[model samples]
Target: MTEVVIAGIGQTRVGEFWDLSLRSLGVRAIRAAIKDSGGLQPQALYAGNMLAANLSRQAHVGTLLADFSGLAGIEAEALEAAGASGAAALRQGYLAVASGLVDVALVVGVEKYTDLIGPGVEAALATTTDSDFEAIHGLTPAAQAALLMRRYQHEFGLPADGLAGFVLTAHANGAGNPNAMYRKAITLEAYQKAEMVSDPLNLFDLAPNADGAAALILTRRDRLPRDFPHPVVQVAASASVSDTLGLHNRPEPLWFAAAQASVEQALKKAGLSREQIDLFEYYDAYSIYAALSLEAAGFAARGQGWKLAAEGESGLQGKIPCATMGGLKARGNPGGATGVYQAVEATLQLRGQAGANQIPDARCALIQALGGPASTAVTHVLKRAD
Candidate 1:
């Protein structure tokens, strides 16, 4: 199989863009990605989207986005895996290039979530869960994550103020990120006193829904431009796994077995161990999710994730530098676009373009995306292709 490298990546400023339509957001990222790749256009395109059918009352997003971006006549396919849709689309593009089906491919993930007001948007996101069980029982994503947070806290003896550290760290990192939604540094007092959305999860604990898009251009390693501004970031491995849709049906709710499996597969495929990963960008839809993901991904042992966070060694300048870009907590969650942003950030770190958040000599990074209460997990390992 050919080695697939990330040629370029692009993302719009994540926030509530009430002015931009869904197609416009997609086009913005697509155009930026093409320009970032030195004007290289792909032979095919893959878009990762969730809730376009219900959010916009529209379908055929692949062709629509392709034509809107002035890439008509190219084979465009839509890949959906709930909130992990973006990573799934990138997986397809990786296979296309790795298997020699296409020399170059464009992958974009976008969602216009703000199109629907409060109840409407909530309803659309709930569709990512089990419609017959979880959703019907009024279990919002926050509520589900809250249950996990409670379990995690109880098992690990996490301090009541432990979650405040994650929020504070994310906000501090986000201050340097112009594209992040919440860039101001947050205080522990503010976070602790914030309005309660769920019992264990507060407003500061959840990632806000935003309208944005992100894109990446991938090509075979040998095809990379000689004069490119940055070194190519190779897609070392990509793995996706699914668990029981209903949280109660899973044998263990405290631990995410599917996420663990996906990470193990990805690390094995990359021929690397957790210790080799210089940085990590995992799903942080909620602060507790970050802890759970770190443990499941082998960054920390079970019931010790919050302890690791409390050690002041998990931020951008910390030992592992988890979510140096502020992540979903302060970076804002654009749903489908979130995973693509993770890949883009990893690529930037590998290329030494992450500015203030750049890790010193960072060579290897991991990107993990989770969907619907950890029911679906996708893990990708990327390394500098030097």
Candidate 2:
């Protein structure tokens, strides 16, 4: 089996992009990635998108995106796994290259969520949960996350303001990222006083649904172009796992067992331990999700994740440096584009192109994506080839 390397990665500026069409956003990211990858045209392309049908009223997006990128005739496919769509596409591309089916591949994840207004977007996101059971109860994504947070607090004895630090940290980091959606640094007071989106989770605790795209060009380590500007970062492992569609079906409703399992498998395949990971790009659709994911990934004890945030241990200059890009909380969550954005940020860190957000001498990074409160989860580990 050949080792898969991320030859190049790119992402569009995240936030409300009322002007750019969905196709244009996808093309911009793809072109940037292709140019970054020494101008190596991909033999195949894969895209991850969600809510195109609801947001744009368009289907058969693969052809449209390929045509826009000037690779109309190339083999292109689109995938959807609710919120984990982007990571799922990247996992498929990694398998294709690792299995020697394709020497070079392009994977892109994009979403134009702002096309729909408030109610429309809410309705679209509701489809990710058990439509028949959960949706009937009018449980939005934030509501589900709130329920989980309530459970986590009850189970873990977490303080009412425990999650405030996480939100504040994300906002501070996001303020430094020019591409972030919410760049204003927040304070503990602001977090406590912020408008409540749900009971326990406030407005600032949730990621904004934005429009953006991200792209990654992958190839075998030995096949990279000679003029590649940075050291290769191998995709050492990738794993995806699913749980019951309904939140009530899980054995432990508060814990993300699927995410934990996926992360363990990915770490095993990478031949690395939790401590070996230098940084993490955790899915932060909500602050609670970030805490749960870190616990599931073995970075902290089941209930100790909030402590990591409170102590500034997960900041860019922290011990583990999780979500240096501000994660979805501040960076904006463009549905399908988030996982690819996470991978791209990790790649930038490894390539030493992360500007002020760079993690010093980062060699190994872990990225995880979860859909619908961990109904589906995917984890990937990347290592810089010395």
Highest-lDDT candidate: 2
Model 1, range 29-84, lDDT digits (tens) per residue? 99999889888779899998888888988788888899999999999988888778
List lDDT for all candidates, in order.
0.87, 0.89
lDDT of 2 by residue, 88-177 (tens): 989989999999988999999999987889687898999998999998889888899999999989999989889887888888888877
Error of 1 at 228 (Å): 2.0
List, in order, the clash count of every candidate structure.
0, 0
Query: Which residue pairs show collisions in model 1?
Result: none
How close is each model in CA RMSD to the real structure? 1.1, 1.0
Candidate 1 — worst ten consecutive residues by lDDT sum?
Answer: 304-313
